[model samples]
Target chain A: MIDKVIIAEDQEFANLSVQKTMDDLKVKQYDYAFYCDDALAKIQLAQKKGEPYDLLITDLSFEDDGTAQKINDGIELIRAVRSIQPGILILILSGQYRPVDIHNLFENHEVDAYVRKARHDVQELKAAMDALSKGQRYYPRSLAQLIKRSNTYEFTEFDITIIRLLSEGYQQNKIPDYLKEHNIKPSSLSSIEKRLNQIREELGFANNQQLMVFCSNAGLL
Target chain B: MIDKVIIAEDQEFANLSVQKTMDDLKVKQYDYAFYCDDALAKIQLAQKKGEPYDLLITDLSFEDDGTAQKINDGIELIRAVRSIQPGILILILSGQYRPVDIHNLFENHEVDAYVRKARHDVQELKAAMDALSKGQRYYPRSLAQLIKRSNTYEFTEFDITIIRLLSEGYQQNKIPDYLKEHNIKPSSLSSIEKRLNQIREELGFANNQQLMVFCSNAGLL
Candidate 1:
C-alpha cells in the first residue's frame, strides 16, 4: 500500500540510503527534496494531481544556505504537512533531537515513527518503514528505554528557569536580581539558592557547573 | 578493473552507499570493517590468501566504544596497511576533516583520491572511482581552491604554541611567562605581544578573542 513516498531530507548521503531501501522494497516511486519549501511545493502539486504521497520521511535540521524559508524546522514542517494532508503518515529520520524530543513529537504531533541515524541506521530504517507500511507505529525499543530514563527528572518551568540561568553564567547570588527584575516568584536569594541546591542534590551533581552541563546534554536548554 | 575493494567506515548508511556504488560499477568483491583494527586484520587476511584488496577507502575519525584499539584513527590505519601492502590504492572518503587535512594526507600518505561526504556525494564518489580506476588521482576542484585559501596562513610550531595557549584560556600577557618557563625563544612580553599583533592584523581580526576563534576554526590550534 505504501508504494509512493517523498523523502524530505537535505543530506545527499541520507537520500542515497533511502533510495536504496526504497529500491529493495520495490516501492514504485519515491522522490526527494533538499529544502523544506521545495518539499511542501512538491506535496501540494501531488495533491492537486490526485496522487498523494503515502508517507513523508524527513530529518529535523535543514541547513540554511541564505535562502528564506517559511517553514523553518522539521516540527514546523510536520505541522504544516498535517494541515494539508491529514491522512499521510509521518516518520522522522534524524540524529539531531534527543529521545525526550522524540517523545514530545509523539505527544504533540502525530508522528508515526522515529528512526535515528546511527551505526545501524540502514536496518533500523528498513524495519521502521516496514512497520509504518503495515499501519503500525514504530517506536524504537532502545529509544523507549532511554525516554523512560530521561523522563525521571521532571523539571517545572521554574526549575528550567533556574538551570537556564546557571547555564548562562549567572551566578547563584545574581539569579535573584534577574528573577526579581522580571517579577518571577521566589525572587529572594535564599529561595533561589535553596531550590538550586535541591535540584543539584536530586541530580547528585557536585555544583551548578555540573548541573548546567547535565541539563545541556539532556536538551533541557 | 576496480575490484575487491575494502570500505573502512563505522556508519552503516555509508556502507550501504558504497555497496550500491560498487554494485553499479560491477565490482567483483567488496568488504567492510567498522573499526581500523578490524580493517587492518581483513587486509592482512586477504594478503595471506594471495588475493589482496585492490583499494582501501577509509574515514578519518572512528569512535572508540570501550574496546582497546591497536590502530586508533584512519591515518594510522592507512600507514599500517601501506607498511604491509604497499601496492594498494588509497582513497580518503570523509566529512570530518577540512581541505587542509586532505592536503596533509597527500603530502605525507600516498592518498589517491579524496571524496567529501556532502550533497551530490554519490556523483562525486562515482567520478572519483572512475578516475581512480584509470590510474588518475581525484582531488575535487572545490577542495583544491579551499586548500589554496586555507594554506595562506602558515602557522609555525611556535606560532601554534602561542595560539594553543590562547585557546586554553590564557591571557595574552601571560603567554611570555609560560614561554619563559618553557625556555622558548622570543619570551619577552613585548616580543610576544608584537608577534600576536602581527598575526592578528594579517588575519584582519579585531581582537585576541576573534583571533583565537579563527585559529581554532582554521585547525591551527
Candidate 2:
C-alpha cells in the first residue's frame, strides 16, 4: 500500500525537484506527469497494469495552452479519478486562493488531503508525507483551519427575508401583510409563526424576542 | 451525559440569544453565562455536583475594554476543559478570519466543531445543532476548502538556503563554499549529494534533470 505514488503537476521543475527529494530519502518507486491528461492516463495504466496509483498529487490550476479549451484542470482531474476509483486518495496543491472551489471539491469530490505550495521549504511538507504514508489524510495546519472555520447555517431565502423584516421593528402580526405586499411565499400569520417557532427551536431560543436578539447579534438582521 | 451544557460568549446579546434559543427548544437543563469565567464556574460546579458539563458552545473573541486583562477567553476555556476533562466535546462559534489561529485551535485546542457568526438566521443555527447532536463535527464548507488544497513536498531551512543559492546560478559543487561564506553550518560534499538524493527520492523524481525542471516550474528555483 505504501510502495507507489504519482504526481500530476504542470511544472517540470517541481516534478523533478520532488523526484530528487524522494531519491535523497531512498524512496525508489514513483511516477510523474506534466499535465492532468497524462496523469489520468498513467493512473489508468497503473490500474490496468495491476498496480493502481496509490497517491495522486495535483496542482489545482493548469496553464496548458496546447488545448484551446481548459479541458484538463486539476479540479476536473480530481473528479475524473473519483468517478472511476472512488477509493484513490487525492491531494491538491494550489498556488492561489479559492476557498469556495475547494469547499465544493471536499463536499463533492472526496479529497483525502491538502498541502500548500509554501510548505515546499518547510517541515510541513514532511508532515504531509508522513501522514499520507500512514493512510491518514494530512492537511497543513493552515489548510485545516481554513476547512474548519465557517458560518454556514442552512436557512432558506424566505426565512432570511422574514427575519430581516422582524428585526426592522415590524410586529409578527403585521409581517404577513408586509410579506403578502412584497409577493413573498407563505404569507400567512400561522405559517409565519410556525417558521419563527422552528427557527427558535433550532437555535435553542425560548421566545420570539430571543430569536430576534440572536439574529441581530449574528448580523442576520 | 445529555443534560449539562456550557456557553462561553462575550457579547451579551449573542449569549442571551443562544440561551433563548435553547430555551425555546425546551432545553432548560443547560447552564449559561456571558463570560468564559462564568462558563468555567458552571462547568466546575457541575463537576463538583457530580454532573459533568456535556456540550460547550463558545466564541473565540471577547470585547476587551483595555482596562483589565481578558480572563479565560473561549480558546482558553477550551484548553482548560480539555485539561480537566479530555473527552468533552467542544464547539467554537467565532467570526475571526485568520486561518492559522483556527488551525491552531483545531490542532492544539482539539475543538470538535466551528461555526461562523456571519449574516446567519435561525435556520442556520438549527442546522448547526442538528450536526452537533449527530456526534459529527460541523465545519463550514468554505473552511474545509481552505485546508484541502495543498499537496506540497517538504524542504528544510538548509534546503531553502541551498535552493536560494542554486537559484542564483550557483553550481552544485560551489554551494558548500557559498553556505560557509554565508555563516551556514558546513556540510560535507558527500552529505550534500546524499541530501539532494534524499530530496529526489522523497518527491519521486526520476533524475536530477527532472528535479531541476520540477523546482523551476513550481517557482522553487
- The first chain of model 2 has a TM-score of 0.63
Fnat: each model in turn: 0.32, 0.00
In the predicted model 1, the residue pairs found to clash are none
Best by TM-score: 1
What would the per-residue lDDT of candidate 1 be over residues B1-221, giving only the tens digit for each residue? 68899999876777778878888889899999888999999999999999999999887767665679888788889889999999899888776445445667766757989887665677888898999899999988877777767666666778878867755546667888899899998888787788888886777655554554445445554
DockQ of 1: 0.20
Docking class of 1: incorrect
Estimate the TM-score of every prediction: 0.67, 0.35
**Model 1, residue A86: C-alpha shift (Å):** 6.9
- Report the lDDT of model 2 for residue B177: 78
Candidate 2 local lDDT, residue B212: 44
Stretches of model 1 off by over 4 angstroms after superposition = A1-4, A10-13, A23-29, A34-38, A49-54, A60-116, A126-221, B176-191, B219-221
**Cα lDDT of model 1 by residue, A1-221, tens digit:** 79889998876777788878889989999998888888888988999899999999998766654678887678778889999999999989885446556667866757998887766788888898889888899988777787777666767788888766755446677888899899998888888888878986777665453454445556677
lDDT of 2 at A146: 60
lDDT (tens digit, per residue) of candidate 2 on B82-193: 8777777787876444454565665564977777653342334556666777877777777666444322455677875665555444567877777777777756566678
